[model samples]
Target: MKIKYAIIGAGPTGLGAARRLNELGEKSFIVLEKNSYAGGLASSFTDEKGFTWDIGGHVVFSHYEYYDNLLVEILVDEYLEHQRESWVKSGKVWVPYPFQNNIRYLPNQKKWECVRGLLPGERSEEEPANFFEWIINTFGKGIADHFMLPYNFKVWATYPEMMSFSWIGERVSVIDLKTVIKNILLERDQLSWGPNNTFRFPLKGGTGSIYRNLAETLSNHILYNTSVVSVDQKNKIITDSLGNTFEYEFLLSTAPLDILVTKWLEKSPETLINAADMLKHNGVIVVGIGISTSKKDSRCWMYFPDDNSPFYRVTNFHNYSPNNTPVPGQGRALMCEVSYSEHKFVDQNKVVDDVEEGLVTTAMIDDEDRKNIISRWSINVNYGYPIPCLQRDEALKILQPALESMDIYSRGRFGGWKYEVSNMDHSVMQGVEWAERMITGQPETTYRIS
Candidate 1:
């Protein structure tokens, strides 16, 4: 097939690009999707027992008006809005979301330890060298030792020393001793500290519903189950696993940038090869523990820092929407997330069992509740998180421009290899902005190389 634009992967970014191109009255593009479904990592699945599960715990919220309008157009009133009720599990205590801001909820000794570490001269006065140093220097050794260090290692599945701390803008909550003391004295809970303080979710299809609906509008342009095997950048050609070939003037790949460069791109040089090697990512295993019983927990999700749970976080999935459970308003869908990487190897074969036992250890479910467990569904995501590794920026600078010079643009979560802008909103806008830039001469903003 011949086309003006060929987009790879039908996730938020590809769909966003396709949708925007269509809206702009451009009709000569095709979207080749590997799976029979849309949404990529954002996709959801329904088990035989009729329980819905997202790839992981995905909450719907946006920083882009374009994405906000896109949701309004796609979902209309079919979604549910909820205030964020996120928390952390520390010393069998349900501390508020930002663990640092709510250390006062800890047992008296641990609480005192956290406060003492935050005192003047406790933190390093020198600039941090890496994420680990930054955590200790900015948050003090106590908070780092108690929560930041352990929880982060569990979640990211990569050593903090290997990661750069620049991506901590809106993702992490900063602490101040004055506010921490005031909150402790007045007993104030810092409930809202991040962008997702209030978010939305699909009332029926889990989080994937938005992408599914958006793709439907451009169904004629999307070719499902067509996986791109190789890219002939010199000839502007693409060959899929089905033995079909697509030729395009421009290509937008939402697949992993490493996969695109190292595996797919034809005749790639050593510089690009080494650059792709530096791109670090973590895998996630989503274990959905569905119980035939119900619970009245208002907290949406809770983070685990201690060894009580193999998982770093668990969601009260039932609270996301009553429809998430088989019988509305009944049963609990406790979705647990366990991240793994080579640096932190997890026995995937036994993670489900570990997760169930961890739930018991953390007091999320009782031994009696285990008897009530009806569904044990799990999905092993090979590429769950795109780690902002020490060499990430250096890698992107070398890879993105080299591909763009060949009229290929890689954007979105793994494509851009940027966790900060990997949210649903940012992914979609990356596509939308890519389309806009293609149609007109407007420069892109969301996925900048720098």
Candidate 2:
């Protein structure tokens, strides 16, 4: 039977689009997943000791009501809510997030520089061209110099000056200058900022469970372990790795835009080539360490921006949910260390060893803790986070229309390629909105937000 819609990539975004179609009483669709599982990066895994780890560190934080409603509808009682408590390790001090607002912890000289930078001067007559300038203008030279510049370079694998600031919306927190000064003088913490003050997590499984359950709802329509080998856009047909072919009236692709254009489109449209060229991404090395420890109170994920640690972030997987790892009575702890790099040939064993050494050097885990090390493994995911470069807008402006002309809707983390809306909820909504737009000719949230 010919399908009304063929959705590729069965991640949250694809599943979300399917779910929305089902809710709207439209069932003439099928989902194609490259992996055997439903969740993409959000998927979970188990080690020999029954310790669970997510692809990276995924926290469930939503900005849209639709995401919240859909997650609740699918997971229901299985969901576990978590209070967001995060800290940044800077200059041998654990400063609370919104690191700018809490600069009292910094040395007096640094603090004075930050305050001085905040002092309003003749505003630059020219538009801030790069992300660094944009950040310096938005948060003052203080915060940018102290944390934003160095930390972002590590995260993006590119200099901030090379990126564009157009993507910044509600993603980064900008401190209230008056409040920051007051807090500094009073030596008090700035309590309020940003959208995700509190968030939710799935209790039984990791964040992937939510996507897994969502896929279960559309099980009949989803075809797993089916990789799309090629697409005949002119003929509206998709051929899988197994040599099976399927035709569709509309194609909604959640695959990375570059891969889709280079592999499927075949013809190098100027827009497609430019989009492919303008895009850059960072790969993630997720290191999961399982140790036998009884310490239960250290709950929140910690951020490391210092050169001492190779990881940018470390999530206490067990704290997110008791079920995330082995039972407490069984005596085990799971910690995830995230490292970002563009080079693919970096030694995995060496990275893992370096991470282990760094953990001890930073006093995150003691040397004696190594005795309880039962299982350790690393997952390397390429195209983990898309970088919003200086030429992204121009690239997208050309690429979006080209895809639309072919009746193809590209949406998701790397599909639409907008970091601001790349979270699970946002990615899912991108799929839903794209499908809705395809069916009803409505405007899509992904493009509209940009």
Off by over 4 Å in 1: none
lDDT agreement of model 1 with the native: 0.93
State the lDDT of candidate 2 residue by residue for 296-394, as single tens digits.
555477777777877778887777777766774444454655546553234665888877887887777886887778778778888778889998778
Winning candidate number (lDDT): 1
Per-candidate TM-scores read: 0.99, 0.94
Segments in model 2 whose C-alpha atoms lie over 4 Å from true places: 122-126, 329-334, 341-346
Residue 279 local lDDT, model 1: 95
Residue 389 error, candidate 2, Å: 0.6
Give a tens-digit lDDT track for model 1, residues 151-216: 999999999999999898899998988988898899998888899999999989999998899889
lDDT (C-alpha, whole model) for all candidates: 0.93, 0.80
Error of 1 at 33 (Å): 0.5
